[model samples]
Target: MGLTQFSFGALVRTRWAYALRGSQHESLLNTAYALEAAIDEIVFIFGPILAAFLATSVHPVSQLFVPTLACGIGGAVFFSLKNTVPPVLEPIDVVAAEIPDAQSNAVTGQPAPALQTAGDHAAPTPSPEDNGFRLRRLHRPYSAKPRNVLTYRGILPLLVVFVVFNMSFTAFDVSMTATMKAAGAERFLGLQLAMFAVGSCIGAVIFGSREMKGSHWRHMVMFLTLLTVGYVVFRMVMGNFLILGVMEILTGLCVSPLFATGNLIVKDIVPARSLTEGLSWVTTAGSVGTSFGSTIAGAVLDASSPHMSMMIPWIVTLCAVPLALLGWFLARKRPGRGTGRATNTAA
Candidate 1:
């Protein structure tokens, strides 16, 4: 199941990147992410209801058939759109061959004569090496040797933020379940969770529809701060069922935008060649955080109380704020670091 999820997530993100390769506009990327997130939230909102019905009406195993069929059909449809698929980039050597002879001399470690003009004062042409350097700088952002995604400035901090942010967010799930159980209203747990997804879907639509300005890192920090505040409110209203439901909806508002912005940051920072891998890492980090948060929240609920479990989200989010800030600082320190837009590259 983990492998299947990882594969699905990686492929989906890669496909999105490919589909959006032509348009590097921030608003377009945000809208695409928002739409995808909203769809996911809709699935989350209704998937369980359908599963429950199937399990109750038929065999429990029957619920799995729906998703299996959906995956097969979705994959077929997605792959059928050949025009949307990005072409595999040509090799560096092939690209280099396209350069003019004067520029290519630099690449081949050969010297070329300076430009001569009709007048006595000849034009002072740049050296072959200088021309080559300039050509490479113009063509691609990264070095000939591809570096690991984590090696990029600000990436490590951003990934750390991803892990912690997801951990805190997911802890709410376990805490909410515990809270409902403690209140002897376990049946309402699904409704409570669905409200959260509903709010996230609404938030994604609103966020994606607008054009946002400012650095993505700063945007992430702002959203993280809002999420932290929401979690704090969640902690305060744990006991009241109706109030808790409302808080869940309010808090969930930040979830999709937060993730969508994170993806934007990854796109900005990672090179074209490594974009898919970088996205997969983000997905992996979230998965790891989810597993860790669930385990920790469950243990806390078992050992202590539901209230204590609720505390985990805000606490971790509080910790994540500094990491987000660190990412912002690092990004600022390195000018032109993530400013280079990624192009389609071969695997």
Candidate 2:
């Protein structure tokens, strides 16, 4: 649900940009954003809503498949639309009938301009310079050059920080849902998640504004430290759903800048061709870490009390304080590295 809300809101802005810009690249990107937003919205809203309604009016487990089927249909519709549309407009060449070459001047060794037809009257062909067409030449977009691109070497460490941070948080998230349900507070869990998404959006906007002004890796570290404090507050509030929701929302607002900063970092460091692949690998690493966290958290639930589940996320999040410090240290060192000098104290 949290992911869906963020995705949908971004898509709204993206689609408008594409429509106004009328650029084929933007259009294709916007279409993808729209389809992804649709699928995520359906998946996030349908299953939980169905579970809620069925728990009250129908057999919960028996009707679960209805929502599952809805998700499948929604996904299929999105996929079909995606396939129906080409990714973007392809550059095409329009050809005209070739005119036979005329004899060259013997002394100057230059061919005479050919004749042309205009309104049934013959006209001398214009020179290449006057005609604005080269007989044989190569052309490419200004955006194509290697130096105009960024690469993974500059961005890999930033991605590493992102994956580590998200891995720790995702672990907390998996445990959070289970913990809330165990505490008999499942009714408000969806709403809490939605609020978290809202906060994240707000945070992203704020971070974007600041990034436009200048970079702030030290500030990010401070923010993460503060977010860790919020987690501590969250852990202390055991049975209160309202408090849990509020704290989680605050946590989202605090940490989302860090999430968004990763993208900015990628944009700075990665080349256009490899950006998607680099981001995918970063996400994959985070997923693997989340899986580990989930397994550890879930295992605690099976063998210990529900309250004990908070330990995993808390431990993992705390691990990030040192990691954040390291990130800040590296960021400071980055500028100095270009000049081959050490400026700041080491982490």
TM-score, one value per model: 0.80, 0.56
lDDT of 2 by residue, 1-347 (tens): 42432222332332333343434443233233333333433444455656777777887575767755755785566446542332333233434434334443445566655556567475655656644455454334433443422232434455555555655565566667877787787776677556555555555555544323344455556666777777677678846767877777677666555544443344334433334444455455555677677677778878886577776655666676676566555554543323111212133
Could you tell me which 10 consecutive residues in candidate 2 have the lowest summed lDDT?
336-345
Clashing pairs in 1: none
lDDT against true structure, model 1: 0.78
Overall lDDT per candidate, in order of appearance: 0.78, 0.53
Candidate 2, position 189, lDDT:
68
Predicted model with the maximum TM-score: 1
Tens digits of per-residue lDDT for model 1, 171-197: 898999888887899998889878889
Output the TM-score of candidate 2: 0.56
- Please state every model's RMSD to the true fold in angstroms: 8.9, 8.8
